[model samples]
Target chain A: MPDPTSSPTLTVDSAAPNPAPNPAPNEASNETLGRFNFLAVIGRIILAFFQQVGRLSMFTASAVSHCVRPPFFPRQLLGQMVEIGYYSLPVVGLTTIFSGMVLALQSYTGFARFSAEGAVATVVVISITRELGPVLAGLMVAGRVGAAMAAEVGTMRVTEQIDALTTLSTNPMKYLVVPRLVAACLMLPCLVLVGDVIGVYGGYLIGVNKLDFNAASYIQNTWDYLETLDVVSGLVKAAVFGFLIALMGCYMGYNSRGGAQGVGVSVRNAVVSASILILISNYMITELFFAQ
Target chain B: MSASPPKIALSGVKKRFGRKVVLDGIDLEVAPRESVVIIGGSGTGKSVTLKCVLGLLKPDAGSIKVDGEEVVGLGDRARERINTKFGMLFQSAALFDSLTVWENVAFGLIQGHKMARRKAREKAIEKLAQVGLGADVADLSPSELSGGMQKRVGLARAIADDPEIIFFDEPTTGLDPIMADVINDLIVKCVKEVGATALSITHDIASARKIGDRIAMLYHGKLIWVGPAATVLDSGNPYVDQFVHGRADGPIQMELRG
Candidate 1:
């Protein structure tokens, strides 16, 4: 007799084949169907990606055109500048200072192995002005301001306030998106500039107090090594990152559907996409400035 | 008496999203100074009709003429010019939360017409009084008001610019019975006061009777019956009779999924 363990398996096999009603003939067809489905899913994903990219480019073009057009709202623009730039100072300041101190410490530790600890000041200034200052500030604002913009605009979309604006003969694009875009693009560079100063100061404090360096020479090294090109490239990157962050935030919020859950999705998407765009664009900008 | 062109008209209008059709060949007209209310259940395209006429939506196929001028695909500046003659009250009141009550009311005036702030404020306060709201509430945010009060403020805003046409979207949707009647009265008073041609969409029979001069019943994306509001209860049409009575067993079957 067949082994007892094999009995259940034998019975299941018999039952499965009978229920399928000619499974042998359909197996190849089923495999083909599954392969077709897999290909279809991938095709749909690629199409959706390109569709989103196209829509985003169109939105950016319209927003830029509106910025240059007439009928601007000065009060709205001013209020946004205060909110985006001035109110973000404390958080941005804290981030850059801590980053500067840590960079100084780590660079000194690494260079001391080669008896090159004197290079700490140059490293700190260069890193802060070229990369750390703008990147850190952008990531922080993406978390703070980008999420807030998404939530606010998403709520307006769901509640029909944006439609109400249209009914009132006001263009929502001109009134809402234009002001935020202009404000973010203009104000982020200024924030990065301030952050650069605060960051270098933090590095200086650490060099004098913790590392037993001469304050005068530390200052001299920082000022002497700093180049105008480094600062200008970073500021330009900050402006581009600002535009990307605001555009992504506004785009997500403007297209959000449903209710509270929709608003939540928009907020999460705004932060995640803004952060990713900031990092990706950071590389491209650095490559542009540094590549031979 | 001569036959004048309708202030608003829709002929063979159709709109669909993907495979689902929301409006299929809708034809309607609202004469100048007339209040026409369309009644239908959820997803029956009542709001879509109003939006089409307002140029907030573009129908897939049809003609929407306001005063003999086709508005189906007008440019932005032309649309804005046409929209100056229109005002709308949303289902949710939809006041701007960022602004105070007076600012919300004066928004169309200040932003659209470029009115002076002082003059707009005075006009907003005056409109507020017309809707039974006091000047004390003008500085408060929209969140602080009761639903009824917010509705009143919305009405004040809609008429503040003296628009020639007004659209009310579910004017009495989320209110107590007494407050609903009060809003009805205010709508009648406001429409008469502003002398605006009105178009509204709602499912409340009582509201339809009170605010609508002519009642049209929309079913499956088509207006099945249009008649005087006073005769709505006895229209004798199966769909109209079934809907006005709110009966479950009727020719218009509710799509229930098990």
Candidate 2:
């Protein structure tokens, strides 16, 4: 006798012919199909958006929480800052400085055609402070620091060093994400500040030395055309872009899959995502500040 | 000898990823200062089992006790405290490329435990030597080392903290056979020297036999057979025999992609 509590067993009948319920099984599949028909599309999009937003906010929060905690690896932070902020100086400075000089020459040429050569200072300062400094800094950082962060952490993730960190009682977020995020947040603004000065200085150098403009008059005019909001707003944008760049770096790196292929993909994604996010955020902030 | 509780124990641990079941249910135990090697083929959830114990992957339902303390659902702080007693050598030699070999070895000691740099440096150098690497290699970046040397450095780092529980995941993979044997020997010597409970997972049967006092074979997310290393060949289980012989014509089928 079969016990009442016994589990059901599948019995195979060698001699019996089983009938195929084609229509019934097909109808079951049809019901399964209907369940996913309209809901799938809308649910997928919503899930995707929420997932993106969740990841972004989670990255931001993980970074912020680690910023104020102990087990502070000052050496790692300072090294990252130097690597990210200071080492980036030459590239950002050169890009903006040349841009400033080019802007001056271009402005002179354009304004000269219109018989408005005196407007060069206004153009240079407004363009450099309002647009070039933050954007150029963001792009350079996306290329340099963002790619490095992705590659380094992606390799770690693939190789399971991140796992090792957790096993060792060290939080990978605290150790990896925090220092980078904090360094970027703290350093990017400073780098942008430096980039602003250098870019404006480049404009001055070209305006006076190459463009035959009077130095005192150029400086005075450049200063006169500047509003506090322009500088403050650019700095604000730098801060936001800084956070985005680092967040993208950490996110892509942390979530990297596959192996060597995955690390390469992560690096590419980090740069692309960070650059796009920076531009989008820059526009949003600009609109917020000057949306008259 | 009077018993202190087992160093590590898992009671019917199970883990699943979506529809794919990684570990169905696992029951394991590692006594203090004992070396247990888990042998399994790829995709047999060997790594998953190790990760469940490491707390990297949370099991769906079951208890994992380390030092007789329940760790399955511990909070972050408690988890961190528990993790301090564990060290792991990953499948790949996952040394920090940015840091020198010595610094990589000293990472947990300095970063996690707040050991002073000088002392940590000294300990790191000593650990490196214990792994048969010279002091000169200590100052060089991990990127500069060969795969075998990196594995040694990884091993050094794993034991640098002298953790009570050490997990080695595919420790001998990606190395020359001789170098693999060398690593296996070093792992045995190191684990023995520290008296640390060693739990390892590998597909390498040779490595399993070499390092394990007791060996368990995982098949279909379950431990099919466990016995002393000397008796593994004669375990009398068809699955274990099929696996140990590396045969394709057994219960495990080879999927031919046409």
Q: Which candidate tops TM-score?
A: 1
- Give each model a TM-score: 0.94, 0.89
Across B1-258, the per-residue lDDT of candidate 1 in tens digits comes to 128778889899999888878898988888888899999988889988888888888999999998889999997778878888888898999999999999999999999999999999999999999999999999999999999999999999999999999999999999999999999999999999999999999999999999999999999889999999999999999999999999888899885531
Candidate 1 positional error at A63, Å: 1.0
- Residue A283 of model 1 has an lDDT of 98
Best by DockQ: 1
Give one digit per residue, the lDDT tens place, for model 2 in A1-292: 6654552442333323344435688788879989897898899999999998898787778678778877677787888888888899998999889989999999999999989998998899898888889999999989998999999999899978888788878888888988888889888889988999999999999999998899999999998989999898888888888888888998899999999999999999999999999999889999999999
Question: Per-chain TM-score of chain B, candidate 1?
Answer: 0.97
Interface RMSD, all models, one decimal each? 0.7, 1.1
Which segments of candidate 2 are over 4 A away from where they belong?
A1-46, A109-114, B1-3, B254-258
Residues B129-241, model 2: lDDT tens digits: 99999899989988888899999999999999998988999999999899999999999999999889999999888899999989999887788888898888878888888
**lDDT of each model, Cα atoms only?**
0.92, 0.88
Deviation of model 1 at A194, angstroms: 0.6
lDDT of 2: 0.88
Please name the candidate that would achieve the greatest lDDT relative to the true structure.
1
